[model samples]
Target: MDAETNQSRQSALGDLALVVGTLVAVKQSVLPFTIVYAGPVSTFSAMIVATFLLYRRGLNWAALGLRKPDSWWRTLGLCVVVFLAFVGAAAGFGAIADIFFEDVGASGRFDFVKGNLPGYLLIMALVWTHGSFFEELLFRAFVITKASTVLGGGRGATLAAVLLAAVFFGYRHYYYQGMHGALVTGGIGLVFGLIYIWFGKRNIWPLVLVHGLVNSISQTQRFLGA
Candidate 1:
């Protein structure tokens, strides 16, 4: 490649690095002060900044799988598929978990989220918005894609990228959920990664739906004391 093109690519990557670093810093800073202390605003805000930066650098929405799909209905159908896959996987893993690990720290999340109806209602909204939108943008769109390229693009790269994202996803939950919860959440992250692969990295609508639904359902179940 020519020096000019190479220079442009390097500059863009440097911006991406800055974006990711800023995101981590922002998320870490806001957690102690907010009700949604997990910092969805920070995550979402960083993404907005990153999107603008990437755009200025000539990166399009497609690079983040944000393009409009050919058929919204088809994407909805894919949502159903991924959601069912997630539900089934969660149940299966839970059953297996019941056998070996008696206390998996799953109840800790429930205790934290459960509250009076008003508080619970607020939590439901936060869970869906944060889990579905911001987390997906950060983890699947930017992290997984960049990880794949950084690991050296190929089949091996894809596998490594998916697992890399999954591990980090689970690790994010580790503080709240402990080892068992982290492992299960990691498995769900793996499922999301698979869905991302199936979507051909061209559309992430289904992922957003599936991810939102998962958190919404989980919150509902917890609210119902189930």
Candidate 2:
């Protein structure tokens, strides 16, 4: 292989390794289910390692395109639009499905009777924060960028990365939320992948915030229901 091709291969391999490492860490952590779900330190560590690999491999942070406009208002507006657009779309689709399927997620929606509100809120808050940061770091910043670097700009690589990450993201939920959760989370990953590509690897913080906001809303709803 030529020098450029070899570098691309190495970058792609690094991303794959990062994803695998994160999955393995999630599987092997000794922390209690609640604790691990709440904090997600294993994922945090895995992403840190991924970032190091990217840096060592001379991956460009600028290429990741995380920088935002200088105006706080503009940034906040963009974030709000992105978050609402995605969440609204998901809700609309879910509502439509409810018409035919009898509230598919209603059973798992919120169980306030079984758990106290305070504890649930605390756990959800932690998870929302930790989960968003770790997920974006691993999937968007590392996985998508690495894949793009290797596969070049085209539909094939983008679709491949989205599908692969969606699988992993779905499986990650299976341990906690079961089959439906896996499906929903996988869809979420797919959306994030599209957004990552749309943004040209820059400004992933919006995605991170949007993700956290959605999780926070779900958690709040659950808490209130409880």
Candidate 3:
């Protein structure tokens, strides 16, 4: 590789190391504050810190996969594909789980829906978008980028980074959603991770939309069932 390529690789690796250390430490340190503080504040703080580090290192939005789309039509097509892929995968996995485990039935989600469809919709939109976009931004974009850079860019490194983020992502949801949620979210994380890598980490608008759609569908079904 040329001197410039070598330099870029080194820089990416350094960024990756900084990112991993920050995430690990921030997650652990912030837990103690949950009694007095809660919700997305901790994540928001971590995001701000990560952004500061990137800016200090002279990293721009493009470098962080924040590129603009070429055309609206193209963007729409990409959105459809991502939506189908995400929903289809989620359904397939959920079905498989249902078949193997009788106890793992789809019950609780609909309870919320049946009781209050409108309320569920509103809550889901807020939670999913906030959960999906920010989580994606942090894990898929920021964390994956750092890991990929540090380990070098290739299939192995990419998959490794995805797995690493998925573990943490899965853990984050485990408390609220239980083991089932953990599995589903982890699976979602893996798919989203691949999509980000495949698209070279461009604007994540479509992913956010898909996430909202998926959550809406899931919530609506529950409400209707109830």
lDDT of every model, 2 decimals: 0.73, 0.65, 0.67
Structure candidate 1, residue pairs in collision: none
Better of 2 and 3 by lDDT: 3
Q: TM-scores across all candidates?
A: 0.80, 0.75, 0.72
List model 1 lDDT by residue over 74-192, tens digit each.
99888888888888777776676666655456545456556458767877787777778777877777777766666556788778888988888877766557777777788888888
Q: For model 1, where is the 10-residue window of minimal lDDT?
A: 101-110
Clashes of 1: 0
Task: Mark the 10 consecutive residues where model 3 has the least summed lDDT.
Answer: 34-43
lDDT of 2 by residue, 49-164 (tens): 77677677686445576566456576677688778667765765455444543323534424542357676766576656566777777766677666655666468877787777
Residue runs of model 3 more than 4 Å from their true location after superposition:
1-39, 96-125, 216-226
RMSD of each: 3.3, 3.9, 4.6
Per-residue lDDT tens digits for candidate 3, residues 22-66, read 655665676576421223544566567777778987875467666
* Alpha-carbon shift of residue 216 in model 3 (angstroms): 4.1
